[model samples]
Target: MIGFVVEAECMFYQDKPIHFECTACGKCCTGNAETHYIALTPTEAAKLRKHLEVSEAWFRRRYVEHLTRDSWGIRMHNGQCAFLDKHGRCGIYALRPTQCRTYPFWPELMDDEAHWQAEKKYCEGINRGQVVDIKVIERKLKQQAAAEEHA
Candidate 1:
């Protein structure tokens, strides 16, 4: 027998061609704050205020939760997102935070097939629709990371 060394591409490459398409299930928005907390920057909060046509004080008082003396996140109501409408849809889908926009494509969920499938319990869109391109996933990840950096 002969010995040889070989390298494989990233482990995730093996799980390629993953499929996802948001069906607006809203399960992700309805969870304990720890698992579903959506952090927000001051600027993101301001945008949301403008979108809802609410005053700064009302927006902060109604929709913001202070995680720390200086940090804040979207307020959770009855263990669900404040913006999740009664119909299980995002009320501000057009103005949702980066965290909300890049959903199941998060780095944690895309870790491997197991994570992806595990999350399927909450989000029916996983592996159920169009095949998500790896590059698009990468881009979304980067965009989310950047936004979270300010959160």
Candidate 2:
């Protein structure tokens, strides 16, 4: 019998640097009905609520949904992030979840150049502006994993 296997190139191990700089075009913040949701940690929720000067109960009622007993995601309305403004900016930019903070450079996207190329279609910041070192990218990945662990 024959079997097929696919191995993705590891950008982290290969240490290929990539350039990125947010243009604030807000494409990443918007999604269609089929694919728009942002998971949030308890820490992220608290931070957002504090920024908005709202109570925890109010925050949950307005912006959060329980994905599972241990997982929570931001609400999506009208096929986009609930916190996205009409001006194409994040309404809660300062307190956006780690997932949002780490864009284009998400571990999965960074796994291979092909993934990064595909992502460039949506994110203008990809392969542009400052050349981010692989070490910085690795640190961001660890931070994302840590954030997910805590959440």
Candidate 3:
């Protein structure tokens, strides 16, 4: 099988740089194509509950889908997230789940080469973007994961 390889430079904190300009194509939002929902931390779940102004039980019943072990992936109905708006923008953009906020840059899930290739095939943004420093991306992903854990 032909695999996809990601190439980028390494840099320190001050010099690390990366940029992505979303075209608003909504390709990432289409179906469950390129996205895999990350399990929400307890704090994250509580925050989302408050942000959506719903009870924690209701939020869990409606929006949270159980994955392996104690993990959960956000549930989607009819090919879109429950929180995805008509304009292709996240309804809870400001307080969206950590998984939604970290797109094209998943930390714990990107280690599999086969999965990465599958993602590259489905996401147009991945192939067209300018070169980014991998070390920078790694750092940002780590930070995001840490924030989610603490949220």
For every model shown, what is its TM-score relative to the native structure? 0.86, 0.84, 0.63
Q: lDDT for model 3, on a 0 to 1 scale?
A: 0.60
> Considering TM-score, which of the candidate structures 1 and 2 is the better prediction for this target?
1
Q: Which ten residues in a row have the lowest lDDT in candidate 1?
A: 1-10
Best by lDDT: 1
Candidate 3 or 2, higher TM-score: 2
Clashing pairs in 2: none
**What is the per-residue lDDT of model 3 for residues 1-151, given as tens digits with 9 covering 90 to 100?**
0121232122221253334445656556557623555456666778888878998789999988777566766677677777777887777767765655666665433554445446765566654567566665666566565655554
Model 2 TM-score is 0.84
Answer with 1 or 2, whichever has the higher lDDT.
1
Which window of 10 residues has the lowest lDDT sum in candidate 2? Answer: 1-10
Stretches off by above 4 angstroms in model 1 are 1-15
TM-score of 1: 0.86
lDDT, candidate 1, at 16 = 70
Question: Which digits, one per residue and each the tens of the lDDT, describe model 1 over residues 1-151?
Answer: 0110011124363357878888878888888887668877888899999988999999999999998887778999998899998887889888888888888766666666687788888888887888878788876766766676655
Q: Highest TM-score, which number?
A: 1
